[model samples]
Target: MIAEICFTADWLERKRTELGGVDPALLERALHAFALLGHLAESDLEFVFKGGTSLLLHVPVIRRLSIDIDILCAAPAEVLDRSTDGKNRCGQSRPACQVASD
Candidate 1:
């Protein structure tokens, strides 16, 4: 189930209490993870969640600890005024489209 991120100090403290007896480090990590995932879920960009974060949720009895999140995203191609590709340092033809999200 998708969970909403809460910003209020009371809600945050309550959430910590609900999680119950968690190490401060683990609780901080979990809160950060949920907050980030909630933010991304609220965004318009299309994405595929991957890597350690995925394993943390999907795998059972895994030994390694996850400390990071990874995602792959795609956006519609668009033309731009400048080129950022190093190989296209000197444009032979027209400048390639640039993604402003960078």
Candidate 2:
């Protein structure tokens, strides 16, 4: 099951200790990246998560935190438009996902 990202002081403290005094802002950015990733996963889009952030999270040898997410969307850009359900958790219209040009 995919977990939702919730911000709390206790979460911050735990991360700070776990990551050896990494900046709180960077951690927050990471949280946002995770949230976005979770949203993407819940959608119908097909993607492969990769890059520095992926390594930092999954590879124990990488001790540094990355502030961004890098994903390769396997589906066509038009599929992204059809997949979004409009309203998000915040009741705002969800923005269309953009696939980076190679």
Candidate 3:
């Protein structure tokens, strides 16, 4: 069964008006992003949710809609030190950083 998260077009329109002209399409995408987060929670990967999206979700007063998803891995540094095809500045391989830059 597909769980609902108030992703109706009507709700998007209403929210767009409430936020003083946020795009309904963007609002819908944001709802989909939250749905993805729900799925992520059920997975084995551990992470700490953060950034503007987190603030908008948790803090009612923050009316600005942020489409970005920022998260911190719960894994230890050693666990994160996997070899990668890319390298960051200072010529050190950072998988997470490389992925973000891509």
Candidate 4:
């Protein structure tokens, strides 16, 4: 599962890089999103790092222009459901999710 998340993140980063010169705001937003994802994965999905986001956390320079953030999860379905369903572990609906889904 960890491998799966890492692969997914890596793929997304590659996609971002392919669309070269993405704006700083957009990059920051993406990184923030990844941080949220990491939190969710850690809290609800019980994910542990397998040297995934460590790269981003340790290297400040890499954080600036990182194509994407990498994360490892043991439960992909839980992550997907939480992400799609817009509910955190506490069962709170994320307004952003509702708006985006709508």
Candidate 5:
């Protein structure tokens, strides 16, 4: 048999509290990654805030909960070129750097 249950805001807060709070090291790493990405983009191509990272910057509290960084490029081709040359901050391949859009 299956039981149906609904989660409330209070339940979510309890769950978050039980999760032991956010990791300081992880947050530092994420911020470092964002800085590196910004530097790489500035040195190579043009980039603008996009997706979750943009939202996180606007909402400081959200940054504590964010797990990853998101960025948008103005010159995707240039980004690809820099990434292929191993100049990207992430040091990923061009194909890997290619952003997927629907």
Candidate 6:
């Protein structure tokens, strides 16, 4: 069974002491969001998450945080389509359309 770590003041302080750089509040938020994302993508078979947030969360020594979630879907771009189940989650292995900053 997976044990859930609760966020208390002591835990936040521990993160602050260990990282010694990022704000504790930010760490809490990022970790919380990341954990949620991990759960969201748990059964997903399409996208492979990548980029800075992935790096920071997956790497034990990386204490920095990013403000975005980047993903690279393994399915071919041809399958891109939104789900019709009234949920925003992708369907048919669709690529989430995004306009890059470039």
* CA lDDT scores, all candidates in order: 0.49, 0.65, 0.56, 0.47, 0.48, 0.54
The per-candidate count of clashes, in order, stands at 0, 0, 0, 0, 0, 0
Top-scoring candidate (lDDT):
2
Question: Which stretch of 10 consecutive residues in model 4 shows the poorest summed lDDT?
Answer: 93-102
Pick out the ten consecutive residues of candidate 6 with the lowest summed lDDT: 90-99
* Per-candidate alpha-carbon RMSD to the true structure: 11.7, 3.7, 9.0, 11.3, 12.8, 6.3
User: Pick by TM-score: which candidate is best?
Assistant: 2
lDDT of 2: 0.65
For candidate 3, write residues 1-102 as lDDT tens digits: 124536666777877888788878777767665655554454455778887788876675746776556768856554334312233221231112322421
> Between candidates 4 and 6, which one is better according to TM-score?
6
User: How does each model score on TM-score?
Assistant: 0.45, 0.70, 0.59, 0.40, 0.45, 0.56
C-alpha RMSD of candidate 5:
12.8
Question: Which tens-of-lDDT digit does each residue in 24-78 have in candidate 5?
Answer: 4554445444554554554655556566655765763452455454656566665
Candidate 5: residue pairs that collide: none
Candidate 4 residue-wise lDDT, 1-102, digit = tens: 122343355655774676575664565455554555544554545544434445655764453444343445555564556644534632342212311210
Off by over 4 Å in 3: 1-5, 74-102
Worst 10 residues of 1 by lDDT: 89-98
For candidate 2, the per-residue lDDT at 83 reads 55
Error (Å) of candidate 3 at residue 61 is 2.1
Q: What is the lDDT of residue 101 in candidate 4?
A: 14
